[model samples]
Target: MENNNNLNNSEKKGIGRRDLIKGLAAVPVLGALAFSTSKKNAYDQNLKNSILRELNIDASTPPPTGPMAGDPVRLGIIGYGIRGKQLVKAAGFMARSEKEKLQKSALENPNDTRLKDFMEQENLNVRFTGVCDLFDVRAEEALDTVTTDDNKPKRFGTYQEMLASPDIDGVIIATPDHWHAPISIDAARAGKHVYVEKCMTHKVNETYELYDAVKTSGIVFQVGHQHRQTQSFVTARDVLRKNVLGHVSLVQACTNRNSDNGAWQYNIHEKASPETIDWQQFLGNAPQIPFNKEHFFRWRKWWEYGSGLAGDLLTHDYDRINCLFRMGIPKSATASGGIYTHKDGRDVPDVYHVVMEYPDFQMGTSQEKGKEKGFTFMYSATLGNQFGGRNTLLMGHDATLELLGNTITVHADPRSTRYKEMIKDKMIDPEVPLYSYNPMANGVDGVTSATAKYFANKGLLFTYRNGKRVDSTHLHIREWLSGIRNGTKVSCGIEEGFEEAISAHMTTLAFKLGRKIEWDADAKKIINVTEEEINQCDFITI
Candidate 1:
């Protein structure tokens, strides 16, 4: 997990003033050179502003309360792709509102002029700091949206350059999957906290590297598994934990979409040109190939940059499932699927299913321990978007819980005849006291009857548990900020992020190898591979 920052110093030795001038000098000769040049300038200005904001030396005198309260932590965003842009909008809204509130409070009391001026300065306080991308245009575009009047962050043509900046307190990485690990590792080594997008790393082994670096760097880290923070999911977790559904054994989850665009057939922008896209940066550690707009914009379609639907969709399910069950990495994982619909030359599967097994565990010492039944997770995703519509079912011995959209329904196990009879008896039990006169006598039967009454009154034939759900989006972001401020471990820390990534990789392997692969969880290696077979396919890195 630790990074070698010193290596960055060595990398800087090669790019000098002449090299920079020569690079810029050749730009005009290239197609759409003017656009590239302007984009580059815009990125540079953005980086400069970001630097000022990081130091709290920008015009905004009094920073709004963040994790550090009086001393707000500066966040430098590295990519301005879709997710990065979204983060900027979110952070911008937060900063602007805080500034407005401070201004209003200052006006209420003339003695607050100092705070007023600070608010004015802070209004334009955030610095874009540093931007780097293989495509000069993407870096430029990211810079343009980040800069403000008082702050200008430095712009780097490459992520390596961004990490070299001393002003950055933390970096928000929304790069392609291939670039996620390297850039994050480099930033961590440079002593900057990291907030990486979902499916943290592309390679399985890279997960271990990230986990080690974060542990040693003493910097906060958060993974973009926002679903974990959702209120509905939280409510689901509570109901499951409370065993309202009895002994849970099987859990099924899925995400289905039925549109050309939904299936990642993204609309190719007519404006996309060499000047605005960073082709090289997008390529990162993936095998070098010709600059293709399709690959650059719709990366999830290819195996080089992404693990297809598994990483994009399945990983989210894995993270949430892990959270709900308090399970570690899956004991074993197997998958099957293919490109059944999309005829494009994409390397990823469109329809896929993966099954994870968690064998039973025992509680207490060996002599006194009792075995606890384990559970199976059946996960699936389809391109057709069938209308039985998408949903997750957590089935237990007592009842089954269904989560679809915002509504959650719990049903008594259809196979439980005995429980059904008991429920029916409770409904007719006139002897059942609304307020028990003899509390001691109203024992097991009273508790069971009361449970049935609670569900019956809600118009639910089966027992149901409901409540106001948590807003996962806010919770996930808050968790990240909190981790940064307190140096605490994040819910989706590096280890979990890595495991999720690894699980996705395994799915891809299963499809390609056309066989069920057994993973040695302890050794963290593919168990069934022979030496000769190993040389044929590159092993998955975390």
Candidate 2:
């Protein structure tokens, strides 16, 4: 580690070699070292830290990934809205307007390292050959963003038209939830690799169709659960493997966003009209509604274009846990909640609660055999402060894990068998974290807006690798491109995506139908729920 640090010019701040090695003297593992509160009480912090130290991951070890030196992978982008723009930027391309905004911000405050971080982002050999967006303003802006001196990106009238073109090798599907499966299926059939956004499918049938299409296509497919690249999460997997948390019987993940932006009340652009936006193409298989700006701008608020909190936000929480431990589709799901907060004319629920049961699953127990078997995964969310809560908690018999964004903290249970001696001797406090992994311990990186803060906290924005700040989405895209270029395996492939989509869709159905939803893994169908019953759903039709 010292040898590597000596090779760099330690001139800059924040990400400098000397600055990065600030907190990693005693621990070395992906820059994430164990840390506790600075306020030292009566007992010494070192003694408390020594007894409960965990996360034995080798920080010096880098991921075995291939070099990106091949010919650029020709890519097409569909849907260039908020998420779409962010996705492209993560792939080493930022819009001129956003770049200028960052430049102004950096000029005002030296601490705003976003522009510097972006300029230093490693280039993944990929090119945008085509773009398909319903909005003309966004499409033209996307063309400007992707065009280069050697390669000029073309704007396609529709995704099918883009897929039919031989100029493209793969597609990035950032469209609404309803179009995720359709566009992905089209790309798969067109023999193009895909990097689609999360909540992979809007409906149950679409989920199956997508799974089948990707399987038959023989093309590289990757889902956009970018946090799969998070360093703390990678370490958390190791922690779970060592049974540091014992048998996690219950996991609770919450979302308590109060702001209008956090609640999906996005601003409607003034120039957004039928002339500027292709309203019909945007609708796709969704309900034929009279052109409404609210439905178009803030599509997440409606069930037609989005799947409410279950699909939009909960998928992140679900996939986060799923990635940590490959706990596939749950045996049963029970949901209950309603539109308690944002009472605008949207049909989808604002406050949501879902309980998914895994009857025959286990997370490797430290107790007697067969003692700890099944577990319940609970998801709760609200648009306001009434039912507000923070932190995604993994409650185990021996300890509890708090996954708040990029930081991971594990607390020993008071009656834990694994840490009973440490608790008895007062070497470890039940209230205090047994250990924690904070990658930002050396310095701080800040984000504005409640929504962006929420994502950054959840490790969706950026993470550090070998002391350098890196975007998780960029790593995700690079993994897809690597799979396309070098035949390497992708983390969030078809099977993982299937589980995420099915789990989310089941929870959504349970909430809508007011009953327990069960999945038959053997038959690969929703048990007790018929095709006709699923089709009759108003939200599904919408």
Best by TM-score: 2
Quality of model 2 by C-alpha lDDT: 0.85
Model 2: per-residue lDDT, tens digit, 1-542?
55445636455234546655676654654333333323344257568446646434432222645678878989999999999999999887899999999999999988789999999988997899999999989999999999998899999998999999999999999988989999999899999999999889888888888999999999999999999888788778877887888999998988878899888888888889999999998888887888888899899988888989998888999999998878999999988888987888988888899999997887777789896788999998888862324788889999898987777888889999888887898887888888788877887786866777778878889888876788889888988888888889998999999999999989888987889999998998899787777876524552
**Candidate 1 lDDT by residue in tens digits, 351-381:** 8898877765211111112323667788887
TM-score of 1: 0.69
- Model 1 alpha-carbon miss at residue 175, Å: 1.4
- The Cα error of candidate 1 at residue 350, in Å, is 0.6
TM-scores for candidates 1 onward, in order: 0.69, 0.89
TM-score of 2: 0.89
Worst 10 residues of 2 by lDDT: 30-39
Q: Tell how far residue 524 is off in model 2, in angstroms.
A: 1.7
In angstroms, what RMSD does candidate 2 have relative to the true structure? 11.7
